[model samples]
Target: MGAPFEIGYVFSFLPKLLETLGVTLLIVAGSLLTGIVAGFLVALPRMYKIPVLRTLSGLYLSFFRGTPILIQLFLFYYGLPELLKPLGFDLSRAPVLFFVILAYGLHTGAYAAEMIRASVEAVDRGQVEAAYASGMTSYRAFSRIVLPQALAIAVPVFSNLVIALLKDTSLAFTLGVMEMTGKAQTLGTLTQHFFETYIALALIYLVISFTLEKVLLAAEQRLKRHEAREEKAGRSFKLRRKGSYRAVLADIDAGKGGRL
Candidate 1:
């Protein structure tokens, strides 16, 4: 039979679980960095519609997105070493954390590719044309105008992804990496207080998630403020142009009246 729940034990387990929080965060950070770079590269072929590369990118996305992350984790953690063994390279002795990050990163890249593609597509094409008309190169226009807008559109979604990644780090424990969840499992076993241990773990996750949300929300708001200022400036410029046109028309009427 399971031990009775003890509320006091929850508090006691908190510090022990917190000790491994950094490991969990490290997984998220490493995976996120890897995912962003891979995602952008993967997205490029699709965005430009390159022939063979586009097909390969599509397949990459399909396999990663269609499969469960757990399977991917196993594949990388176990299968990859064997695959590399035939090539005279060995990964059997590599750090477990490395495989964890790689698997998560690849999984994240698949999702991020879609996010990046959609975000970039959401930007107005007319702006790019306008930039072209102003003599800017395609690269310049994209970098200066399109990328900023796309980033603004992407940030909210990316924030959600980050939160998801943070939670997903729990799976890293399956490979015995001793992350937060792994630590909780050990604590629970040692103390025989599964309920309290888990409750403490849940609380830690909640607090971290909440803090991340708030910080990302503030960043989103800051980006929106920049957008707001640009819009205001645009409105003022239009008003000034309108006023100038009116003055020109009035002067033309005065000249015609004098001639009459």
Candidate 2:
């Protein structure tokens, strides 16, 4: 018969798993920071339609997006050192966390580049033209007008990528990073309570993921509210202008009729 369920093991291992949750968060945070910066850089060429840069950016996306993340991690962790060896660089001495972060960052960056590109493209051209017509420089127009709108459009998609990155951080365990998944594995092996250990791990992940979703949803609603206010104000201004024009037309009619 299979080992009987030990309800006590779940509570016993919960703290250990929670302790490693911070490590998981660290991996996610590092990867996100690097990935976001890289993604923006990768997106620039595509957004501006630069000839050679766009071609290179497309290749970057194709390679990173097409490959599985695990393979990417291996490539970054193992392959980078080999290539850099001739340059007197030894990645083997560096902390595994560096490689883990690099791998996840590169992997996440590809998806982020596409998301950023799409978001930037989604911004209304009319708004951009209006900014330019108002004497805004290209950079100023993008920063003041296009970027804000693009960020709002990108947030929903970015939130999804954040969640995915959180889950993907589990792969860091392969590099001996004792993240939540790694800690859970250790607990499972030591106590021989696989199901209980994994259940605790799963719960921790679910709770964090749920919290992120709620926070992101709240931010999304706030952006929507701000947009709604701007739209309402625009409509109100238009209505007031229309009312003033009607009053002017009525005055003209009254003056003409009196003369008649």
- Against the reference, the lDDT scores of all candidates come to 0.87, 0.84
Q: Could you give candidate 2's per-residue lDDT for residues 103-171 as a string of tens digits? A: 899889999998898777667787889999999999999999988877877788889999999999988
Clashes of each: 0, 0
Runs of candidate 1 exceeding 4 Å displacement:
229-260
Predicted candidate 1 versus true structure: per-residue lDDT over 204-244, tens digit per residue? 99999999999999888786677668667875221111234
Q: Which segments of candidate 2 are over 4 A away from where they belong?
A: 230-260
Model 2: which ten-residue window has the lowest total lDDT?
236-245
* lDDT (Cα) of model 2: 0.84
**So what's the TM-score on candidate 1?**
0.87
Give per-model CA RMSD.
11.7, 11.6
The candidate that wins on TM-score is 1
